[model samples]
Target: MTAFCATGAFAADYVPGELVVRIPPGGNVQAIHDAWGTQTLEQLSLRSYVVTPPAGVNVEDCDQWLDADSNVESADPNWITESPEAKSAIIIVAIGSSTTQYTDQGAFARIGLAEAHQYSTGQGVRIALLDTGIDPSHPVFQGKLIAGYDFVDDDADPSEIATGVDEDGDGLTDEGFGHGTMVAGVIAASVPDAEILPIRVLDDEGSGTLASLIRGIDYAVSRGAQIINMSVGLAFESEPLENAVSDAEDAGALLVAAAGNENTPTEIYPASFGQVLSVTALDSNDVKASFSSYNEEVDVAAPGDGIYSTYPGGTYARGSGTSFAAPFVTGAAALLFSAGTPGEPGDLAQSLTDSVVVVDSLAGNAPFAGNLGQGRLDVESALTGYLAEQATSVDGAFRPYGVQFFASPNPFRGATTIRLSTPAGTTMPHELEIYSLQGRRVRTIRSDSSDRGAWEWNGLDDRGRHVSAGVYLIRSNAGSLQSVGRLVHIR
Candidate 1:
């Protein structure tokens, strides 16, 4: 059996000549190994084992034996994986925190920090950041970053390493070197009081195997992290990786991940997992970034373009990608955690969704809105949106409002179906009107006695021309009773 380690930043892909075997629960581990002529290299858990073939045997032979074994639930080669290469596109125009180079605009201001800070500074909340490691001495993360395991070097030092090579071929070598630091900086800037648990899964070359990522997830859960931010991702799917994410969510961690920077719809692991809150990126114009990958799994959008944050050596630099956007939500989740919000990750996700002010341009016209999770991340609104939702009226009045109105694909890109439901057989004058947030009536979506039916809005106004991207209010009236719901339209 051979132990593998990369010597340089650009080391040969070390495909471990071993297998990760997950035995059925309560299955006899000794019996299974005895039948396969393999010896356990490490016991990840009672049911999960990393095993290697005998000295003279072929690895494929051992795999065949395990595949045919009824006692083995799942077994496969311990595949070598790497961080999403697109993050190498992170363009750093200037470095260091010097007043001349640094923009005064803080990362917090982009996401409405003034209002969010009033509610929570993420005090007492712990967020686990899984990335290439972090610089321990960065001022922004001085007391907040708690070092976890270094899966690469297998040591206590989780410092970010640079291979001095453009691992992702973006013309910049070691572009991912201080990636973790930047991500941590974003979280710190958003929630200065929140605790950060840094986990080093990727190596100096911005590559890590599935095992490392899974280990990081397990550690994040065990360390009592309320939020786990995965700024890195792998393109291929791995069962073990998916299971680890699920386990983290089950253990009460709000898992957030980058949606990848390939600018394609292809899903990246962990982020693509159902348990994770996949985040996309937006530019200064509040428009979807051309490089931000979009898909159905995207949960929320955040400012990722030209984001300035802390870097190594007591400096700061600007970077961009979904990798940066994810931490915004992570910081936001830390606020929810610090507030002791009731419910699991799903509830937290829903709260963030409801809070978004809505980037209407992401509606039906662009393919990044409805299909991509919910909407943009409104940190302040998220902190207060839940309470506001519970109260039907601003004064907390419980009026008997009769009709129920809802807009499907609320943050729609092209068109949406609005449904107005009322008590059956108690028909009154039914009307559905679409109005801009500015109080101007755009169109009358419906005006009939039909209590329950679906009406389509082709993203146009009464003038029959497509309206500009913005929030639209749907008002439903039956007799003297009225109900209102919000619909977001995007170009």
Candidate 2:
């Protein structure tokens, strides 16, 4: 058996004598195998399959031969990938304890998560987490997980388990254990209400093949995941992987990946793809971490050093790597979806880039300048700015609400006029209240007489303090009549 290497200086190490091929619809798999003298190994998806060439046929030759066949759409070697934090040690802080105490970690404050939560907790978004399996029973994931599968073991349960053997030759057994739990923990911490779909692509050793990763992507899309978080990456690009990413994007799912941990300009697969939101890591000082890969492909940065999150066995730990950094962006995307920011994946990606905190001028980051991406993530700014932009671009259609309730001059900088119309001959007292997107009541106005229906809000809360600029909801109740309308406030 001959080894296959990808086309690059830092080529990816792939399996020997194995090829992943895609067959067009209605193509005869048996005929292709008979013509090429190959054996079918596994069916990855409806149109993709894993096959082994006949004895003495090199992987490269088999790939070329399959590509030339009329039935085959594409063929490539099944490349290998690893978790970014596969070798890093995790410092376990607490076990079987309430997760509320650790919610105030520095990473949360650095990214303005507390402020961001005031707008949205990712109520209606589902994130597909593809990594080493997760601890399904972890306290942080209570009521946060949806149905998922384990491609490695070909099972329905995608739970993390410890294997005693050392897979990476690092003299430590199960170094990759708890990796998925940590990644899931980060997302749960950022968006407590967002549902997570845990797809186990990598094993406990943090090693997975391109075939499994592709299958995981297909599963996530089939399960209706809005965002896919991939903390694992290949050293070199593969056509099969890129095709999977394109399919996911076409299905309206946003892909977020770690930039890799080689600390070089070399691009990594999936992350290097233009459709993906490639994320790098930053320390507490707002500078790039020493081990994070950086280049023009990086889309954003997040706190990844000494980051604390959920661990296996219902515990919590602190670790660092670009793997953890990618989930922060994933969580932020969930927030945008929950806040009703309407658009495709590209629009959401633009919103995130436009709201980043430019760290080029920060100390210790002068060397990386444009290579570190837009900057460290600021979740609050991303949500508010996106909401405001959406508000201004619309025709102010009252599709979401009834015609009896509406706001004029939406996207107003200072204040806007709100009007509520009641049925004729109604004499019950009416009450109108303003609320943030997260459902926090901001102001309340009451009319004792039924003759009045218009009120001008000065963008102040009940305490008479000015609220920050963002989207707001106006709800009114008059006995049995209730109406809801949306408005935008700009600073």
Candidate 3:
């Protein structure tokens, strides 16, 4: 277990995408697939940059194990080990990595000052992060945050996010900085009932590689993060990032991502993936943010620009961008999951987007109507559906009175059949568009006829490929008539 000081970024730049481990690792014949790594320990590294060992194939006797972080953590069963024949596997979660709340007398939230006191009030859940480790001495997080893994080099304490000491020789985080600290506050604040994981995915200077994201996501899922909010994004997609998302999905966790401030329809990775919930920004008027991207590739929209949230030092900020919107949904999701909802992340996404309030016409207001999604988020309505079950009106011809869609399989598996109909006899030749949860148009099962009827996706996309396990849509159209029905693709 040599204290390897990793200075450079991961050999591979991380982007979010599908994780596929075509082959299994050695010794662990049951090791079917790793949501975060393909090669298991060979690909996984601890904060100390130490190689992890395969499950049941313990490296306690190996020299690398001896050199790893003295407090290095491992998944309970180690997802990198075997397959219990689970369609959706279990994973560890790193909620609020450290909820010690060291800043406010041992129990204080770091952001969302307006709701600061309510941060951990009654979450009954946890807030996990991966940034400047926590100050266990802080009262708010002390005795909270439960447990976490320190990925920083040479540091026995996983709580230290920025240390003036480069004890491990890693060139990063020589000084104390708070990146994940702010992120944790956004998700955990105004909800004292939740916990914080502080997984430490990023180092000081707001920079991280795919390796850390993978390890952090894996650790969080394993620890049980039902709502994993990522207030971050990358330019391109990476295999490791994709695997991280997959792992979280397997654990039935929602990966809430920031839609980016690029202000263009072209998307950012991870948030642009099919499994994620891409949140855009909408002002108080329910208008799309100028910086928010718009295109057919966006799923949902939320209050982003000029939004406020928690930061380090117990202070609040008026931070803007889709980064904060991701948390609105993340926190709401936590509320739902803790209250017995948000079952599968893939489905949670559809629930949030399809039922969102259609105010000010997000499509008409934004530069690109397709990317802005369904206007703004209505927390109570979104979670419990105050208006979901009741739409404005379907009228004759199944025309979209405001913004309502149709789908199949209330709780279906792969290839759930879907059929949409108009108000008896509406004829339209519009294409049937199928968009993934992340807003990417995956399969367009065209309805060549100009009449109402049924069309089968066969659970396959236009690319002739079978998508992952999650929620999907079968958008119907017949000239002026349109409807969006929800579907599920199971393995």
Structural similarity to truth (TM-score) of each candidate: 0.71, 0.82, 0.53
Q: Considering lDDT, which of the candidate structures 1 and 2 is the better prediction for this target?
A: 2
Whichever of 1 and 3 has more lDDT, that candidate is 1
Q: How do the residues 385-440 of candidate 2 rate in per-residue lDDT, one tens digit apiece?
A: 87665554232353233336657777566777777765676543356788876779
| Ranked candidates (lDDT, high to low) | 2, 1, 3
Tens digits of per-residue lDDT for model 3, 1-491: 12221112321332222121212112231232232222333344222122333334432222233234333222211112100101011111222334332223111121122332211132456655545455444444545576777654524455545446553243633322443444455555544457767665544434444455566677787788776666555655444456557667877777777777666665665777777777777765567766666656567777655544344454443445666566666765665444332356665666667656775454448346555766566555544441223222233344443323444543244544455545545564346787764568888765546443555566677888876534454566565656665553434
Cα lDDT of model 1 by residue, 137-187, tens digit: 876777887768797788888988877876645476775677888888888
Error of 1 at 207 (Å): 0.8
Over 4 Å off, model 2? 1-12, 25-28, 87-101, 168-170, 396-417, 420-485, 488-491
Residue 93 miss distance in model 2 (angstroms): 7.4
lDDT of each candidate versus the true structure: 0.71, 0.81, 0.49
Ranking by TM-score: 2, 1, 3
Top candidate when judged by lDDT against the true structure: 2
> Which TM-score value belongs to model 3?
0.53
Clashing residue pairs, candidate 2?
none
For model 1, state the Cα shift of residue 327 in Å. 0.3
